[model samples]
Target: MFDTTTTPDSFARVFTKGRLSIGLITPLEAYPESPFPTLKDHQQAAKQAEDASFSSLWIRDVPFYDPNFGDAAQMLDPFVYAGYLAAVTERITLGTTGIVLPLREPVAVAKQALSVDQLTDGRFVLGLSTGDRPVEYPAFNIDFEDRAARYREAIEVIRTLSENHFPKAETMRFGTFSGTLDMHPKPIHGRLPIMAVGRSGQPIEWLAQNVDAWVWAVDESAAIREILSALQTSALDGRPPAYGYSTFFDLDPNPDAPYQRFYNVVRIGRKALIERLLHHRDLGVQHVALNLKPSRRSAQSVIAEMGTHVLPALEAA
Candidate 1:
């Protein structure tokens, strides 16, 4: 089981052992026709989410826009945006869907994460991934094939710096930490909750032992159950880490419409969405971060509707 004593408030707010929490992914406005969002009223939208009782808000790291990939992904640096949001929203948990770990220096990553954690008053969660964009690797002079190794190394560097005082450590790709120097501003809690977004090129067993949580893009209940079962069986100390997923959501305007899927997006009515989420809760999913970029309506409208309708229903359920 997770040591609640050492976990940040954001981790507990977002991931309970048996319940499901809902969060909105940033660029929290719809831009169905283009790759980029206008980011209009972005701050207001964030505050709206907090006011609506949404469990958290997530930002994505898209360092470069590959027109081929077609999504610009919020177009702001995630850490900077997260810091900005920290000031505007008081209670909502702030997080990254993930930072592409291999593309950035690990020590800098640790500093930024701790800075956001402090700004949020212990309301930040750090999600990291081995990036999927092959085009991005060569641009950074990094080998695409070596990301898995680098990803692991980055996590070690971040953790060692966060959890220890003047921690002496040697790493293959990220240089060494001398015992004479220490990273400043340790996590407000003893540690920041590190979530692995997607497999990040690691085996399930490795994730089970290393990360505080795991999230991917899986859509089926049975598939989720199977993966959760595998994670439970492989977990260290017989305790499964929290599990969650992200989805491109397109909520139907009608409250009674049935759940429908279109590739990675789910186009469903509020009622069925509630049922689906409840099902996920029963299956042991700890969080669900919804990306509303695919919505036909304005993202603000969707947020308002879900807050007024779906969130209350989930609470009652």
Candidate 2:
């Protein structure tokens, strides 16, 4: 049911092939290493990000707060938050940095995904993953070792149920299905564009063949180059899936703050941040989501700067 024609879905329009767009990760506040957001004025921040014309507002899928895990993500259920944000904001796409697929049933996930898609008027993008947190797997009573295989199974189920009306299939995780039952509230374009984070336990080729896009963490441009090179070699048919990368940014108070790397994050100023994003674009990144929790300034100001300076520059390029 997916539209393979020139008319792209809302998600595909913003995350266009061969172009780069910037999006903000939510709980939009200066929490640094802490999991909690001030949350008091975040509704306003969400409005601001949309006004600033960010391509999307992203939320994380953190089911629980593992004290040892340190960061609790946005501290909200992603689907719930997406539904809320979809109502609160206009025009901006609602996305998940990822939803943990192996933890939930495929039909349930499909229903929720399509619900959000309709709620947002086709502005939803599904980013699914196998989930890396060991603490979360056991908490859900799922075997950590089987997650990869289950993840692959769930992908098939989601795709099948989304595209076919009363699909017939046999699978280990989703069980057998006949043409007797069909998924309801079909996606706006008949299917939602599926993106995956990391490997999700499948080979690069498998991911390349199935998913519309792929996301990963990058500390440097070299990693992006390697991924782009690999994508060129293993892409489905001749259509290479879009590649995206995410990083934490601590925007310095100075407008001309220099770039410095810390682990997977960068503590940099707007000028430097713009330079980095353009470089990422040059490296074939279709999209990048920035987490502002590490910033010293208010999330409002960071959002404004990115909206005014960063996103515009990238869009123009």
Candidate 3:
């Protein structure tokens, strides 16, 4: 049984118990159906997010550009950008909206995660998943069908390395660690908070027992609540895993504009957005990363508005 009462590290604190916080996903600007974003001002924007009281900044892992996928998504390695962001920002949590676990080796994952953890002083959270893109699996020479097994094995290997030095681990897919070799710069919290992205082909019970939290796509509050309610009893050791989701949001320049739902986004004013976030908090969602790709306003403008209006409203709520 995993203990839920343990004090969370800084990264985990962004998604603290019984609280809801808002964050922005990178390439923070409004891309609007384009695969590219001008990243020259990323550092300045990140600093602004932290200063504005945004809880976290999320980076995504898209190793290669596929025409079918349509978006390159920051076009920088997530770990590299994470380290860069950690260096620039003072207190905002640096997280990977997700890194595809099966595409990379566990030892490398552990080392990179630990490096960022140490660099940020325990301000890193790893959102992990077994990737869904078939195009990438073949390019990496990994069998797509066996990704679930690899993902599970990789997690075990990472956990073993994080918790124990000179630990022996035998994995069916991730090879073996004979306790002879050990990795250094372990996570500042003994283990980094690993949030499982989507289903990753694992059962609810398994995820609840293993990962620190669950990351999902944003949906209607009622629907999201129904799903979470169903999983209430499946949590291992009677501690429900924290819930997070990615959402598309376009904050209108008009603060009083009415809410209008888009395909995957909700175009609304700050008042409506604050109400939505508060509703999600009531439904037990601890954190939500807002994707501004569909936004109508520039990232700078949106961030300013949110900082002045939306963020304060959430805090007050």
Candidate 4:
């Protein structure tokens, strides 16, 4: 059970205990031929998503474009883009698919997250990761092998700064806070909903105890169930943190097309999409962030279709 009283509005809206909410990952466009998105009409797409009753919008932190890695995620600073989205949209929750924590300073990250939370009137969720690209570690002059410890340290620093006034804290990577000064712009809910995006070099037990939510990319139902069960068991005070996943989604133009899988992406009709989401909801998934980067159709068309047909049916369910 989640304590709604303490949950941030964005977290609460995007994740309910028994229901699954849908969100889209940005730059909400299809570019199957290339690794980088044009970022054209992105703002409009975000507005359209909100207008269509989408629950949230997610951004990724990919500071560099690794030709070998082959995906320049969103191609913008997540915090800056989030701020821009916060100003443009009225109600949709803004989130980071994840910000790679070990590659940046924790206190600055805390301030940026808090600022976004305040700007959105509590419609922000902070998702943190250890980062998958080892190349990024050296670029930031950070030790890749030490990310696990740094990841933990960053969480501690962020929490201490956000949840307490004039907090005193000592950390290994980040320096000590001696209670001489306080971090400004506290979370709108008194605590920001911190999510562990991917494992972040930590175990499920650590995530269950520390984060407010967990988002990964697992597809197997049994694996999801086992992981969710473990998370619930290890969670503090028996309150299971929210669980969800991201997938490359391609919604077929036809309403009745069968569900088909292609590696990480799923190409399905609106009807099948609804059924699949319902199945996930039953499996205890609280949210799903769909990536449209691999779609064959235009992003706007898919958004319109989902808004007109899929969302209402899911709401009725």
Clashes (backbone N, CA, C under 3 Å), per candidate, total 0, 0, 0, 0
Give the better candidate number (3 or 4) by lDDT.
4
Global lDDT of model 4: 0.90
Candidate 2 residue-wise lDDT, 165-269, digit = tens: 888999976778888998878888667878887788888777767787788776478888887788768876677678887788788878797998888677888
Q: Per-residue lDDT tens digits of candidate 3, residues 37-134?
A: 87968899999889888889989888988888777889999999999999999788888878999999988998899999899998888889886577
Which ten-residue region of model 3 has the weakest summed lDDT?
Answer: 1-10
Q: lDDT score, residue 32, model 1?
A: 84
TM-scores for all candidates: the values are: 0.98, 0.95, 0.95, 0.97
Tell me the alpha-carbon RMSD of every candidate: 1.0, 1.7, 1.6, 1.2
* Clash-forming residue pairs, model 3: none
Better of 3 and 4 by TM-score: 4
User: What's the candidate order when arranged by decreasing TM-score?
Assistant: 1, 4, 3, 2
Model 4, C-alpha of 126: deviation from truth (Å): 0.5
By lDDT, is 2 or 4 better?
A: 4
Badly placed stretches (over 4 Å) of model 2 are: 1-9
Look at candidate 2 and give me any clashing residue pairs.
none
